[model samples]
Target: MKKQSLVKGAFVLTLAAFITKVLVFSNSIVLSRVLGPEGIGLKKMVMPFMGLMMTLTTIGLPVAISRLVAEADAQGNRGKVKKILVISLVITGSLSIFVVSLSIFSGKYLSSFFLTDPRSYNSFMAMIPIIPIGAVSGVLKGYFRGRQTMNPIAFAQVFEQIVRVCLTYILVQRLVPLGIEYAAAGAVLCSVLGEACSLIFFIVMFKISHHRKMKISRPSWSQAFRGKNVLIELLQTGLPTTGNGFVISITRAVQPIVITKSLALAGVSSALITKQYGMLTGFVMPLLFLPGFINQSLGATLVPAISEANAQNNLRLIKRRLNQAIRVALIVGVPSTLLLYLYAHELMTAVYHAPTAAPLLKLIAPFFLLNYLQSPLQSVLVGMGQAKTAMFNNILARCTNVALIYPLASNPLLGINGVILAISVGVILETILHYSSVVKSIGYALDIPNIIKILVAGIAMGYIGRALFINLNNLTSQGGATLILLTGIVFSIFIYMLLLFFLKVINGSDIVRIPFVGKMLGKIFPK
Candidate 1:
């Protein structure tokens, strides 16, 4: 397999991500409409625990394996690469089995003790087997990434999402007739099967690719056990990388517990509480985070590009990339923030048929421009070898988030709105800390005038789009609400771009990246 260049690989991964996100979003819409918010809540109730279990299962092995394998492969030490794989598999494999076992035996006890809804036991058990399969898959994905082979990994991702969504929808439809619990459990079971399929795909690809490239003599169990140096190297690289995810997963696991307990104390019924939780996570979050695809795609470009620049001690280049990253993030973020804020009700109703989530969406929308920038800023930090700084900052913010959930949510007046407040504030804190760290480290000043211009452009576009939508809303039939909403958002984003282009907020290079017309536009546009 020929390795892809950095740009080509990012393109492959970004395209795959776009496809998978679409599938995931469509799946969410279907589930929300079919199983309703409470069903989503039930499925989501186990997801945090699953995330924590997965974090423990991998234990930084995949990242470790990626780094170690790349180093060994670069040095032409095939034997060391093989050893790294075996050790990582051994470490993660054992952890996976342990997680699977723990979940199996303790499923009832856990759901009863930890969850506010003990009825989630079925969904919990249904998702247990996925731990082992997903852990192995992560290791393989790391191997592929280490080798710079994006195609197979990209294919496997899209394949798994397609399989998961289609299977889950079919299964949920069949099981919803029984009960929401059954539907949720069936959805989880389908996810497990989908992961199994991805693992199998990875295994086949690895075998074929590995055998064709080079033959490796199988090491004895004693030889594998003797890789003390390899284990240390893997642990050293993997642990620090794992820290960020560890914090995130732990915080996620803490959320439902805190919010549910608090809401229950406020005399909110369990069912309504679940529905509200479902509305927030399943509906509101997916929509808000949809625009993050831009940040993620650009962030991928930033890490390697900035990392290379830093290695050369080219501070000027680093400054340029950092500013460009922030600019791009805001370029996507501002319009997205306004779209969600201005059309929250129409969007919620049109997309998910869950209008009740609109308020949460509206409340959180204003703060999300900063939220979207976190990824790009964090990428810059990672490029500068300041990942731990970013991690600790995230830890502090999440701690604040968790601390606020209980106190605010337990107040009947605040309720789930309080939960949104907690989340938005945490996002603000994290992004601000990230921005300040980058600016302080690089002595980089943002393009204040350009940023102001972009903000003014975005604000102007937002009000115009809202007025257009309202006018069209009165003219359009009720059945065409989805179409109208979709059209409105697309036109609004286009308008925002035009405003930027006219205001000179974005330059020729920005327009030059568009697919077909970028060159023509760039040639015509001024610097």
Candidate 2:
């Protein structure tokens, strides 16, 4: 089988992710308006718990499946691929069933204690069915990703988002007259149907694909199930990945509870607490993560790509890919950080209709750039079979966050700002650790000079663009402010590229490194 180029795969996935993010962002905007802050807060509060349940059900099998399948595909072992899929499905499916049962049985206790909002009880219960449906879709996604066939995975994601946005909007609007809790429950219910839609799409795509007709003999239950080897391999790879996920999910699940409880103890009212939580999670964090879709797409493509290269013991290929991934991350992430820092207020007001999100967004913008880079570095570590090291680093970060969050959030002077500080500190620390681990594993030196150059270029572009926006803002009304900001953003990107060329941070050679546009750029920026 011919391998897909990393850039091509990343581009495809990035396009899909961009669309998905837009749709989801739109859904969030509509839902926020329909449900209001309290309703949105109710949903956000249960998200961490739902994420924890998902982590428990998946047990990181998706990563393991992708890595194992990539290795098997590299070796042309079709039967092994089939067996790996079978084993993974059996394991995750059973775990999913267990999780759903547990959630249904423990909903009341979870709502009363962990959530502290009895109104969130129905939303918590609504997440039960999503676990199993999402688990099945996740496995299929990993399978397609491992095969380096990103189209199906891309299609499934976009399709899922479409279904989710439409359903969530419809349900939330219909249920809003009942109560905010019912509306929140409607939003959660959308997740279940969305996953089911994606799963069905994957199954249909898989059935029609050429791989389904491959002439490999199916492994009997005895042959596939008899050996501890497959189970051991799965556990070895999946456990550490799952451990990382489990720790993060635990912290996430605890964060809202900690924040609300701490704020309440600090004399903040319950309603205000929920509204504040909604602003942070629903508004500010989304803006901080806007550039993440690019890195996430790159990271998703990196795993199977790196795994395949590692399996072949191609050290040079691994180093080259790592360098490319880091450079691309910096190129995109640095400008994003600067843009968000400069335009936080404008963006918040424009996208979320929440001017209050500006302060938190500005506070976290620079640190969030490190968070963006962490995604690819962690992916590289997992791809290089250093998942245990990655897991340890993540656990340390989460533990640190948990230890400090209450103290910071409960402090009268700090409050929610303290929570943001804790998060920023955690992200920076984790990124450094992940980067160090990747360096140690690969024995490749990162290009710090180039990174510095990118940062310089980004800062220069941000100031210049800010000046232009300020001049333009005087001429535009509130109705056209978003358009002007968007126009400025476009100009900012162009200015960044121009500065990159002028500063020699990016030249014809760098331009030629891009996927589809490389040839066009080469012609335009001849060395």
Candidate 3:
């Protein structure tokens, strides 16, 4: 990991994330078409709980490792860095052994008890092997983040996604006729294979680099004598985070169960329940979070950037960075939310061939707009060393959201829509809490005028874009609604860009923050 500036590192990581999402989204489209809603449901039924598995497997050590390593590296203690890594391996490896063993032994009973569908049992079992692959990778990833190295991890993620996409296509096709259960299992196994490949990549990279690419003292094993002290430190630092994450994971895992049971209480049949859940989780979620790449990129860089600023007591720099990140998020995300809302039905029809998801998408888009913007603010908290506060906030939001689901979703009139309403409420609550916390910590100010500017530009773009789509769809008769929708999307985005410059929501300083081409763009796009 070379010492790179925040913009350059974020650029590389964001590009990789973009490619990975494209691949994953494309793969999901293929799988949804092949597996249909119920089949997708079967696969998704086991995925949420995988978060719980991961929280157990890594015990949140990745965060601790990254933080500890960053502190040591700042002190120029290369020997200490290596000792931390060595100790981390011992700890993560031990946890992996125990988690994997326990998973293998209890897979059947656990699946039987938890999953509403028995058909998901095979997929559940198939996914168990990923716990270990994920553990070591998490440690290495944390190490690289601490080192501020983005390329290796970025390259590994895209590579993993590519492999997963290809294997899923081939394997699911071959297995579909056997049964949806087997197909789901095959897809799950494909993910396992992809993760294994990532593990291999990490292992090879670690060995080849030996993490010695920098000027550092020789690797230290003397910590082996005091491994107990290290272990205590690791656990002390990580356990609270692990507990918070475990609660969040459990909250996520329990949601589908709660949603399913509540829907049943609303008198929905089991089959339709599966279909709606599949559509919500598998289809709409992937589409809605499509704009998350921008927020995620900003958040990744925001953390270390703010951390650096805070280290020097540079409150101005921290506030400036926060403003810029939120500005970028709003500029991109508000328009996305508007366009998605305007074209929700067309998008659902075009992407998933399931227009039934249109209402769900439109209903959830506003909430998700807040969701996208919340990332950077949460990162602000983490960067400010208020991670525990942020964790508790998340815990509260999720539990409150879960608590609301049963009451609303059990209503016969609301049904699954009630579940959406519940979570959308959670998003609003979480965003508010995050914003308030950030304000209290740093006196951060929202760019209210610029937000108005984005909304102004986005609303105009959405309306014009929707109008264009309507005209083109009406004019064409050769099944060209999709082509029309794509064209309108392009046209709307062009107009939105022009309006942004006109309204000054974006300016030369923002352009100058671009990774490689900043200076050039800044010259033409002056503030």
TM-score of each model, paired residue for residue: 0.75, 0.83, 0.82
Ranking by TM-score: 2, 3, 1
lDDT of the candidates, in the order given = 0.80, 0.83, 0.81
Lowest lDDT sum, 10 consecutive residues, model 2, at: 215-224
405, model 1: CA deviation in Å? 4.6
Ranking by lDDT: 2, 3, 1
Model 3 scores a TM of 0.82
RMSD of each: 5.2, 4.2, 4.4
Candidate 2, residues 1-527: lDDT per residue as tens digits?
Answer: 23567777787789899899889889999888999999999999898887788788888888887887888888888877877877777777788878888888889998989899989999998888888887877788788878887888888899999999999878889999999999999998897788889999988888888786853234344654664577777778799988877676678778888888887776788898888889999998877777778888888888888888888989898888877788788889888888888988888888889888799889988888887678778888888778889899999887887778788888888888888888888998898899899878888787778788888889888988888898898777567887889988989999999988887877887667566688787889956
Compose the digit string of candidate 1's lDDT tens values, residues 461-506: 9888878888898897567877878878888888887889899887
List of clashing residue pairs for candidate 3: none
**How many clashes show up per model?**
0, 0, 0
Which residue pairs clash in candidate 2? Answer: none
Ten consecutive residues with minimal summed lDDT in candidate 3? 214-223
After superposition, the stretches of candidate 3 with alpha carbons farther than 4 Å from their true spots are 25-51, 75-80, 107-130, 165-193, 203-237, 260-279, 411-416, 473-478, 508-527
Q: Which ten residues in a row have the lowest lDDT in candidate 1?
A: 211-220
